[model samples]
Target: MTVGRVGKEILEEADFNKFRQALIEELVRKISRGGCYGADIRQIIEETLREEEFVNFANKLAKIIEKRTNISKESSNEAACQLVEEEIADDIKGILHGQLEERKGKSKKEKEIDFMGRESKLWDETTKRFIGKKHGLKDIALILKEHRLMKITIVTGFILLIISAFLFNSIYKAIVVGLTLTIFSGDSLRIKLANVLGGLGGILIFFTSISILLQYALLEERRSMELKEMARDYLEKAKRKENFN
Candidate 1:
């Protein structure tokens, strides 16, 4: 209730639109400041209204405030802004509810700037910096990171290819597979689809490379067996020489 707006269902139920639509500006003030029983709210109301608007704002609030206490007059701008703050709360809820009803699928974040009491400039700068970074790749490291996320998932696959080669010792296969998979990276939909197809091709390339590596490993295994046999023959000859001695 203090932060969120009242939904359309409650606003319609309360019939506030039917009764208070004509008194929009006045209602907005009362709802914003949160009507209090003290002079604080009254002072804010008095300060906010002009000579002409005062008559209506006061007259309108008098009827509403009189429900609990007699309407108090405000003498300063500060008092008026505060009073308006309270007045706008209910009206804000009503307006928000109407918007929600109209836009059934979307929700909005509420932003209020209390310029009188806060440093708005600093916050504005920070927000701008954050938004800027999100929309574009500003720095080298970030660009590299972004490109890595492209449809081909270039960064991850490049890493994967490097790892496969280092362990398996096939530079050519690594280069081929890395290139095949890294083709799909871009900040676009069509590129993402292309990346998928490219990845399938890369997978085929990967399997072929694995097959080649397996054959190499088998050749190495056969060469190892031949070396073991030669070593055994030398050891047997050395054994015969020791037995004769």
Candidate 2:
């Protein structure tokens, strides 16, 4: 079988860790054999590149290529074989580099001056934008606006509360009698059953209101925590950028 086919077979298992382990094994073999494993290694990388549609794995593959080539250079070889192996290693490295460059979307720079002063413009935009005293309030407002579920739940709870009030008001006597039937003292079985049902309905409505209020409280807490997390992330990024400068 061709080296590419061999690589395809190795990668057929489709586990990244497995592929990495197998690549390491191949690298060790290549080092021991003074770069005889060059084609097989290159083909393995090619297969990986083909399998991964996105370029997320490009950087990792680049690192692997670096280690593989470094080991190939250190391996012992006869004078004639050393020259041939070195050439093969160089070719492999060059191909890998080219593949990486293509994936990165880099191209030759255009011959143009900074006539628009874009760098200065960007600096001004970044520096001039102030986080005001009310920025925290503004961020909270933004979060509330963005959260549809929280708003919907609160509104639904309010509507249900209103409905419960209307229901209770319409049948107040029934609900009251249902609670204290012994006090009324002239109750038939059918009347008692109706009163009991009316009271249960009122109780269910009140419980539903309580449930909704609890839900709102939980959602509010979650949103507050989320805001803190966002602030922390922003601060971290700013700190890193400051350190980098």
Candidate 3:
């Protein structure tokens, strides 16, 4: 999926992230050149930390500083880590702010140029309103026509379904449904109705087959139980006769 343009430059997902990181690194390097310890730098860092976008960059920069300087991630060095984080964050914010301001200035200039070439029409407002009203009426007519077609399609599908269920076997019903769908499937409304009716028919057939199989299974189970009980009774009567003899 393509991400929309940021200013005049279009950026994909990967490129956007890379751009953000590069901007942050470049800003940090620029500030570091001016000597990393100053009141303005501290203020910038504090402001950058407040912005949500720079939080991850701040953390990563702090870790890099610790690694390079061999500082332990202990309570004693926590303040130092925070200072480093703030310094990087401040630079990133400054660079981003400058870029945003520059884009705004360019956008304003482009808009002014565009406006200069446009002619002012005295009756433009009335013309636009009339055109809009005409389009709206056309849209309403189209919507009504779509609804009427859908209703007709639904009625036809239902009639076919009822006829297939009563006059034919399951295979014939399936074939009828397929033929009816093929006949009416050109329009969007007809296609949707066909799909819905076909799905419902399939579900009903599945359940009907399952119910028949379940009934057969239950009947067989009952017959087996009855035979076992009869055998047990016969054995009891035979033993009684033997005892009596």
Largest TM-score belongs to which candidate? 2
**Error in Å for residue 16 of model 2:** 52
Using all chains and alpha carbons, the TM-scores for the candidates as numbered come to 0.21, 0.29, 0.27
Alpha carbon deviation, residue 232, candidate 2 (Å): 0.7
lDDT of 1 by residue, 90-163 (tens): 44334323211111121121122222112212011110000001112233343334334342444454555556
Q: Identify the runs in model 1 with alpha carbons over 4 angstroms from their true place.
A: 1-197, 241-245
Prediction-by-prediction clash tally: 25, 0, 0
By lDDT, highest first, what's the ranking?
Answer: 3, 1, 2
Off by over 4 Å in 2: 1-170, 175-185
Query: Can you write out model 3's per-residue Cα lDDT over 114-166, one digit (the tens) per residue?
Result: 22212111011110000001123454344436457543544464555554444
Give the alpha carbon lDDT tens digit for every residue of 1-245 in model 2: 11223222222323334344334333333322332211233333334344444134433433333232332222211111212222233333332222111111211221011111122121111111111112335544444466666545545544443443344454455545433432223357544445455545445545544655565556545544443344344445555887999
lDDT of 3: 0.37
TM-score of candidate 1 versus the correct structure, residues matched by position: 0.21
Q: How does each model score on lDDT?
A: 0.37, 0.34, 0.37
Q: Using alpha carbons, what is the TM-score of model 2? A: 0.29
Predict model 2's lDDT versus the native: 0.34
